[model samples]
Target: MQQISINTPALLFPAITLLMLAYTNRFLALATLIRNLHTKYKQGQEDRNLLRQQIKNLRRRLLLIKQMQASGITSFFCCVLCMLFFYIGYEGWAYGIFGLSLGFLLLSLVLSLNEIYISTKALEIELKDME
Candidate 1:
C-alpha cells in the first residue's frame, strides 16, 4: 500500500464532525416527537391504534439514530487513530485504520438513510390519521 500522509485522515475531521452534528439534530427531533406523543397518549387525544403505530415507528427510528451516532463516533475515533498512527510512522497501520474509519462512515450513512425512510413513514402515518 502506498504511504498516506496524516493529512488524509485529518481531512475527515470536519466532515465527521458535521455528520455527528446532523445526527444529534435528528436525535433531538425524535426526542421532541416522543415527548409530544407521550403527552398525547396521556391525554387520550390520539386514536389507540394510531398511537400504537406511531410509537412503534418512533421506537425503530430512535434505535436507528442511536446506531447511526455510534457508527459515526467510531468512524471519527478511527480517523483520529489513523492520523495518530501515521504521525508516529506506522503507515500500514494508519492505512488499515483509515479503511475502518471509512467503513464505519459508510455504515453510518446507510443507517441515516434508513432512518429517513422510517421518518417519512411516520409522517405518512400522521397524514393518514388526518385524512
Candidate 2:
C-alpha cells in the first residue's frame, strides 16, 4: 500500500473546495427557482397540479443538496484532521482519517449525482406540462 502523507490529503483540499463551491451554486440556483415558483403559484399564473408537482420535486432536491453539502463539509473536515494527525506524527491515525475523508467525498459525489438526476427529472416534468 502506498504510504499516506500530509501532502496526500492536502491534494484533496482544492478539489473539495471546488466541489463545495459548485454545490453552493447549485443550491443558490435552486433557491432562486423555488422563489420564482412560489411567486407564480401565489399569483395563480401556473396550473395548480403542475405547480404542486414542481414544488414536490424542489423539496426533494433541496433535501438532497443539503445532504450533499453536509457530507462534503465532513470530508473537508476529515481531510484537515488527517493532516493534523500526520503533522503530529500519528501516521496510523492519519491514514485512517484520510480513508474516512475519501469515503465521505465519495458519498458526497454520489449524492450530487442523484441530485442531478432528480433535477433533470424535474425539467422533464416541466416539459411534459408544456406539451
TM-score for each predicted model, relative to the true structure: 0.97, 0.98
State the local distance difference test value for candidate 2.
Answer: 0.95
lDDT of 1 by residue, 15-39 (tens): 9999999999999999999999899
- For candidate 2, write residues 39-114 as lDDT tens digits: 8878989998888889889999999999999999999999999999999999989989999999999999999999
Q: Which residue ranges in model 2 land beyond 4 Å of their true spot? A: none
- Stretches of candidate 1 off by over 4 Å are none
lDDT of 1: 0.94
Best by lDDT: 2
lDDT measured at residue 37 in model 1 versus the true structure, 0 to 100: 88
Candidate 1 Cα RMSD after full superposition onto the native fold (Å): 0.8
* Whole-model lDDT values for every prediction: 0.94, 0.95
